[model samples]
Target: MDSQPPSTPPSQKHGQTGNHSRSHLTPEEQRRIEVNRLKAKAIREQREAEEAKRIPHPSPTRGTNIGTGVKRSFASMSSPQGPATLRDGRTGAIHTNRPLDSIRPARNFAKYVEYDFSKMTDTKGGFLTEDDDPYNKALYVRDGKKEQKPAHMTQKEWDRHQLLKSTRRDDIMVSGSKQNTCCECGSLEIDRKWEEAFGCCVCSSCKEKYPEKYSLLTKTEAKEDYLLTDPELKDEELLPRLEKPNPHKATWNNMMLFLRYQVEEYAFSAKKWGSPEALDAEFVKRESEKKRRREAKFRSKLQDLKKRTRVEAYRRNRNGPAGGNFGDDLGSGSRHVHQWGRAQENPEIGMDIKKCVDCGMEVEELEF
Candidate 1:
């Protein structure tokens, strides 16, 4: 190594070799590197374009520093050589200026101009003077004069004139009154016309005799009149014949009797058929039997569970206690020995005592 330092490779000697250093790579690797380089370059150019779109345009007029709050001439501000610009006083951001019309103009400009009251006159036809009225004084001006009715006219004349003026000619009738027939008594001399009560024409005598029956009798008489003039009958026949009762009005009992007869005559009917009530009772009985069976199954399951528990208890007792050192572990053994001694002494304690087959711990029996 002291004789000569290892010569650096041509590819490593110069850092500017770029793709030349990659010459040792396969053609596919070389192509992939070139594609990646082009993609990075395209991305950089796209970012530059987006930045350019975000940057604000420089003001055309001189002496205007876009984001600086400096007032400029009105002419320069209004000029459309480029978009007008303004500096936000608070935020310091440059924004495109709005036109004069975009801002709200002074409201009620005409209100400031004093009205000329010299040419105006009062209701008495006198000219208004500034000295006579204060500037803050309010003046109520009626638009026109109203014509007053003559006081010399008679009451009847006044009433007739008012009625004629208020009434429209189209609503007035000039013909004589026509005779109306009484709805109740069929009299042509109907003294009172009840227009609100279904437009009935009832004679005074009939109305006095039966006021409530007038409308009812009128409606019935109209219905009779309509029936008498039926289109199905000839004009020579003034009245129509009575119609039979509707068959659809038959009672439930009649329908049941008809159905019974039809079933008796039908060929495919069942030989032993019961009434609806009897059939309903039979269905109820079958459902009751099904419910009883379900209850019996539930009872059987409960009994079986109880029997299994009793058998488990008996087997546990027959197998003796659990744990190899049942009577040797002083801690648990002492407690069990005490319980066992007591059980032997008292028959009731034996009935209540139970022992675990695995742990040999004496536990009290659980009563269901």
Candidate 2:
């Protein structure tokens, strides 16, 4: 069998260039193809432009400029017109045109005033004493000086002002008279003498006593040089010597031995010394003065009583027993004891408080 020639459309046979592959064409398809090609080109150009904008510029500090011998100055990485771009303050748009010098000063809008620390007292890392109140306090300053009459505040608020002074240590003021209730018993029978019993202040109560415990701590150690150089004893001395610790007492009294040694080693004597007799004389004087004051107080109270008695006698002499017209309405001058006995005996006597027969409960008058 012989091969046959492929079938060719009439458009190809006649060399029609517009529809070179096909025998026929539509106008809409040609237009759509051209539009698609144009869109692809536009998208590629836009992506390239965005990539150029994303690329960062080199800063001065990382490398030196070839032209200049001096070190390169670098702007803040967070600032605008640098490798890290920032939004404009006013417009909120990405900034890149201006240098850092132009944008930095404007970026820091706040004005900070310097404070004066010359008057500030040194704390020395301890509880501040009462004398440090004036020195430790500070005032607000703008440009190394005090701020002019800033603002007026209420008395309560002014008392709590920031410049108000305070001590670092805790102050405990125990007012005995103001303390009415005992902390232990919750009874209103507290007295001034309760705090004297304990070394530390505490509330008064007879029902129970507060249970407390104490521990002795060694805050310092004794040195060998002082003990050996003592005049009372030598290093190679006998019993009760400064160099040797008490064998019997030292077994359970390590802290006491250390304290005794420390005090004896470093103890300094005062220039002026007062004897025991002097202290006794002063105490006797105080006692005598206290006794005189008590006698004076008693005499004053007696005088007050005498004056009251005289006034009562004068009133009784001026008017009769019950005192004029009002006396008749008030009845006889018999004592209230007699009426109280009759009222208790009377079965129909009504009272605010009554004895109950059943539960033996007394009915008490209750306030609204």
Candidate 3:
């Protein structure tokens, strides 16, 4: 070691390596750096605190995920007073912690079960505790067998038959009879109009008395006045109507007559116009559009009229002014009239220059 220090490698020829021989700071400089670092750290912490204050604290009820503040719908179940289970209105599904495939109907619904067509009822024991005899059924029931397709039927025809036969009629109301008593005044005497036409139990006195509610509404009146849509008025199930031959034309389609109250109810409901105010707004908008179209039409007609008048005036002037050879230019034999414009001074020539208003012909004349 004392004899000779090992020669440094060429790669290690420059400054000290491996963090050795570092620059040493003075106490003041080190203090300043430490102070600045502490100040920066404090500022950063303060900013973080402010940011935390600005946003709501992460809550378990907010969502399973952190940061986002969206209130979870399922969060209520975690509470003490939540419902035992959540039920879906449309799907009739009971919400649970399990997977979708694992979920099932609470009770065995006959509609979902396989068909047993030898019997009138769907289920083995029937839905009722006491199975009523088929002949004495309160309502008409039909549940055709799966294997009941007619002989020599093609695959297409068989498939179509199966499709039509698959309709579930377990809970359907096919036909029923109602009481003969009047729905309005309870009078034994009811109108033939209500009973025969609309199949409603309403007396003739009530029909005339409550004109606003019981009165008939034509298809045109329902659409234009009440702002009802085609689907709403056309659907017999939705709004029952009476049909009659068109009074205006026999060849035309039959007129549909809807009850005034039914039309009004549908019109003001959430489905159509929503409210009276909304209907009024729609009417105003339509009227304004109609007025704008009318004005535009009038403007177009006026422009055409103006163009026609201008063309006629041009033709009259070109063919020579009516009843006039009076203003013909000298030595030309052409019938051209000079409707002269106001005279302007020609200062250099000490004369007045006049130009034709229509033809742009100019003439000079000495004037005092």
Candidate 4:
């Protein structure tokens, strides 16, 4: 069978109700639709740009056409404006932030003008008088162009005006505090609270307190080695006045010390990462190895010294007994001393305490 062109919808072909309801559009409608879409897109772009600028950190670059299209579409879908309003059609009386729409009603409001003011008597501060005519005052109405106000006031006028009064000056006296001073160390006037917050100020004449966290000393009475405890100086005393040092000096010093301690202690804390921990761990390991070596050497030397002592004591005990001999008699012919075996014949041998003899006592040799 021969293939035929797909049948056009009856509705589309000659305005009949159809199986396929494809409809044709006029060029005018299509152009109108495109124009409306473009206008809507522009408005949406303006709103997005405004919102972006209001943010803390707006992107410096202008958005691409594609980005603008996306932003516009999203903004329109989310906003309360209707499609007709977006397409530049006459919008309904919808509440909005747009200035024109918000102020339109106010612009249409009838202004009050026919009221009489001549009957009004003078109130306090000369605000009004009975002879004054309200309409003749010529004050600008809301509908009229805004007029610039003049700024001119004499010194007396400003002084007389209660609204323009100068601020009252306050005379606040801050009493100086008595600081701790160490005459021997030449340290003076250290505030503990300030030191805890900022850092220690170590002046040659005065030692300011260091931060509690970063201090080398623990919390307790200050000692000579870690800290100097001095009598508190009275404010009235005429002692040497030291120059006021920067408060941040102690703070910075403590911070640096803290950083150093962190680096040193990071080896023990398992949470730290990177090269800081790695370097410190290696250093600690080496130090531990050195300590172990030193301890081992000390123990080895101690053992040797103990063994020598034991040997000397044994020799002394064996020789100190009755008839105890070192090994040989004074007139021995042989060089060897035989106190136990040949003492009767040779009479030169001395007791050997290192060996066990039949008597159960240690013998360097046998006693003569």
Instruction: Choose the strongest candidate by lDDT.
Output: 3
* Candidate number with the higher TM-score (1 or 3): 3
What TM-scores do the predictions have?
A: 0.17, 0.22, 0.37, 0.17
Instruction: Give the clash total for candidate 1.
Output: 0
lDDT of 1 by residue, 239-300 (tens): 21222233457432211111112222221233223454554565577779999999999999
Candidate 3 has a TM-score of 0.37
Q: lDDT tens string, model 3, 1-368?
A: 45655665624534555435335657898789899999998887667655544655344333443435844333344544333244444554444244476566666563364534565455565453225444443333445522544444577977875665443222134333433657887776665445655667788888888898898989988888977788878898788998777888878888899988877787789987799999899999999999999999999999999998998577557756432343443444467567876899888987899877545577896756
In TM-score terms, candidate 2 sits at 0.22
Residue 262, model 2: Cα distance from true site in angstroms: 14
The better candidate by lDDT, 1 or 2, is: 1
What would the per-residue lDDT of candidate 4 be over residues 60-150, giving only the tens digit for each residue? 2323223334333454456554321222224533223344644434454656334355566646675544246544535334454642232
List residue ranges in candidate 2 displaced over 4 A. 1-10, 14-273, 320-323, 327-368
Candidate 3 residue-wise lDDT at 31: 89
Candidate 1 global lDDT: 0.48
Q: For model 2, state the Cα shift of residue 20 in Å.
A: 11
Q: Rate the local accuracy (lDDT) of all candidates.
A: 0.48, 0.42, 0.67, 0.42
Q: Candidate 2: deviation at residue 269, Å?
A: 8.8
User: Which of the two, 2 or 3, has more lDDT?
Assistant: 3
Error of 4 at 363 (Å): 23
Instruction: Tell me model 2's lDDT, rounded to 2 decimals.
Output: 0.42
